[model samples]
Target: MFSFEDYREILRLVKESGRYATYGEALEREEFIIMRHDVEYSVDRAYALSRVEDSMDFRSNYFFQWTNNSYNILSRKNRDLLTDMHERGHMIGLHFALNGMTDMELIRRRIRQEMDMLSDMLGFAVNTFSIHRPSPAVLAENIKLPGILNAYQDEFFSFDPKAGPDSALRVKYLSDANHIWRYGYPDAETIAAHPRIQILAHPFAWTKKGYENEENYRTLIREKYAEMIDSIDGECKDFSPYREGFMGMLT
Candidate 1:
């Protein structure tokens, strides 16, 4: 059961391991673990995770995708969530999506545009970025944009060679993508043994209770669609005919 309690236990183990460090701190520490959360969906979920981290006095880098329509980054509710996370010492980063874009120049332009927008919205400079489902070409290029640290770059941290590594770097990388641990479950034993590690957990993969990947996604979709219907109905109350079909579909 990969519930919130499980996550809290992981953090507790990391604290006991005497090797946990934030991504920024890992640069100087010989032995450390970098905790990273990519906000693929549900800022509320991310906020919940942040609270757990806060309880442990731990810090992590949270990357948010502006291109993701699953949650509005600019919405008042989400903006407040981001602010709360930032205030609690979690690093806010831009999760850039390539979307099969091959042009380096255009990619750089888009990167800067989103960085500027996010920084302005957060009222602070966002200095880190990670590519969302990057293509082979982008990975090969390893293009570094100005003024932000690339989370995918080798310069950040090395992965341990033994752990079915993903990047060229020599650090142990563990990921919970699609609500399943791709490498292996990052338990206390695994965490204590590794000198340097990178833990990538998607906020949407976790909930207060255990849920399968498909189930979690379905819940998010239903909630977002319901919210959209409410917004539309509120804006066009006079146009009952236009909303009837949409409301019926939702019901």
Candidate 2:
């Protein structure tokens, strides 16, 4: 139910408190709030939020999933959007899922392989990464990549399942997962309480209009549905003339 305006307020709070850095810049810092977004459902939504950040002259890390079923990173539309975001000075990186693999060596290879592929597609070096919904085994591995900065690395994050918003840990972690604040919402007080924090806000949960929770998801579904129809129109000449009518249905 968060509006882009609400998101903007959070951004302003962090920026004013301001020891925040992009993953690349934070590598040199002792304490920072790593402003990050893992694009989950919609690149279009990510683009919307990125514009908000851009308007504020703010920059942060954005991670895109390589194997995401929701959107194709290789598609021309997505490639252009992602590359455009990078050109605007926002850090782009891989949002990876270990997929339950436990062998540390094998995990390293998998990460690098995808990293290389993602880098090639973006036409830039993607040296930072964040894991998507890491399981206990994935966290236990503490998977490391050479010459790369992992957002979940022990130096930046400490995983404690029972940890709460007020719990004092090595590093504070706040997330906007499942469209709900999993830790504590970073109000002025909540944010000031943590010296070192990592904020994982998903672009999927936000919008320009910022509808109520149920309507927000319904809107996303319609957007995805239209994207599917557009793809169908591209590959199926028979659907070409029908595209507008199908699109109108959603409208």
Best-matching candidate per lDDT: 2
Give the distance in Å from residue 116's predicted Cα in candidate 2 to where it truly belongs. 1.1
Q: Lowest summed-lDDT stretch of 10 residues in model 1?
A: 159-168
Error of 2 at 74 (Å): 1.0
TM-score, cand. 2: 0.93
lDDT of each: 0.77, 0.84
Those runs of model 1 whose alpha carbons end farther than 4 Å from true positions after fitting are 157-169, 229-251
lDDT of 2 by residue, 181-218 (tens): 87788778877988788898899888887877789889
Worst 10 residues of 2 by lDDT: 21-30
What are the per-residue Cα lDDT tens digits for candidate 1 across 14-103?
A: 788888776567767778777888888678788888887887788888999988768787888789989888887889999998877889
